[model samples]
Target: MTSNIGSPAETTQPVGISPYLSKRIFTLQFTSTPRGARLARRLVAVRLDEWGVPYGTEAHETTVLVAAELAANAVRHGHVPGRDFHLSLRVTAELARIEVSDTRAERVPPRPGRLPEPELAEGGRGLLLVERLAERWGWCPRLGAPGKTVWAECALT
Candidate 1:
């Protein structure tokens, strides 16, 4: 039930989740470019549709916005030429977890409530939006990789 949503044709098949859990997982790798960021967001919407979360619902909309902001940050701040960013989404009955990993471990976003003042010329409010919309959000170093994954969890209810 994937929606067109301008999803790029480059997406791969969704990975299967662990057998012990009642969860669905969707994972994809994208070029570290603005176009890739947009594709990530659009595919998120499509994936939500496949997961029974209709478009325009709060859950679907929140997850899409989080995907977009995190992907945008990956392209704008964590991009490594010739390297790609990764997006993984895990949806369970209770919540949806969104993880966006980029190859710049040193460029982690500032902790929530610690962001610098908002400026008209400088754009840094993405995390703030994530903070407000996500049930909880944070980041960690990408295991076995020289990078970090910023993650956000949103409640389905």
Candidate 2:
């Protein structure tokens, strides 16, 4: 449940500053569980609101949904016993970026442009939803860690 909020330089910005004129970053580590996933989703909404996106705006909802899907996937697929997942959110003048890093490196998601075949099963559609909602999404090796980071970016304007 630990969280850090700041700018790229790790300095806190004034609350009333225009979101478009400055960059904001929020990073948190959560246990790889369903409850953790839910918390991540909720916190994302709260953070976006504080950044001036507001609760009911399309940008806010889309970013929160992207966070939920990424967090759930980290718990369901990339989880390792005793390891926690990480969520990093960055909002700029034109886009909101969401990154979820997990400790299981071998379970990388499908590539950015390729969509998995739709299955009739009850699961496995999370990435499809991400694809439709995000301007772009992808995964890469977790920097300085033994895992991968899956990320998505949603347009704010």
Give me the candidate number with maximum lDDT.
2
Query: Over 4 Å off in model 2, which ranges?
Result: 4-19, 120-122
Query: For every model shown, what is its TM-score relative to the native structure?
Result: 0.83, 0.89
| lDDT tens per residue, model 2, 51-118 | 77899888888899999999999999999998899999888879999999999988887797676567
Candidate 1: tens digits of C-alpha lDDT, residues 31-136: 8999999999998899888777899898889889988999999999999998899988887777889998989988888776676666642677898888889999
